[model samples]
Target: MSKTDHPHTHQTHAAIIKRLKRAEGHLRSIVAMIENERACVDIAQQLHAVEKAVCQAKRTLIQDHIDHCLEDSVGALGRGERVPLDEFKQITKYL
Candidate 1:
């Protein structure tokens, strides 16, 4: 079934939002640091933190979507059908 037909909420939605917000804060600080002519190493460290936070948030959100969609729609893991190998690979590209 299409997503619209099986509408459901992610269990990790709140945690994901929190992570994104933290990343946003780091990004804004990075901008301010640039404006203040901070050291390159310091700025790079903060940038790395932002990158990790965003990556983690994206991974969590996508994994949650995959898990819930499979379970709710296709009877994944516990049932006979599993998420298609191609579909799983497609999503992993982003991660």
Candidate 2:
């Protein structure tokens, strides 16, 4: 299924987009700093910030996907409908 088809209703997709855009801006600033021969320390600091922002966005997206899609979808498996162990293990890879 397409990404949008996933059940992420509880998480605001716009918030994720905003975060990614912010990270993209930070990355652009870093590139400019490098081209200008900015101080190594200053460049490193900004790079770190950009990395953290991207990582946070990734973590948020994965958590939201698991919380809304995996949990909700698997929950529909009624009584006696066993979820495969392999499927559960695969899903946990994100965590």
Predicted model with the maximum lDDT: 1
Candidate 1 lDDT tens digits, 4-90: 334457889999999999899989999999999999999999999999998899989888978866545454544554444445656
- Candidate 1 clashing pairs, residues 3+ apart or interchain: none
Q: On residues 17-58, what C-alpha lDDT tens digit does candidate 2 reach at each position?
A: 898899899999999999999999999999999888877877
Off by over 4 Å in 2: 1-10, 76-91
TM-score of each: 0.73, 0.71
Point out the worst 10-residue segment of candidate 2 by lDDT. 2-11
Candidate 1 has its poorest 10 consecutive residues by lDDT at 77-86
Model 1's TM-score against the true structure: 0.73
Report the C-alpha displacement of residue 92, candidate 1, in angstroms: 3.8
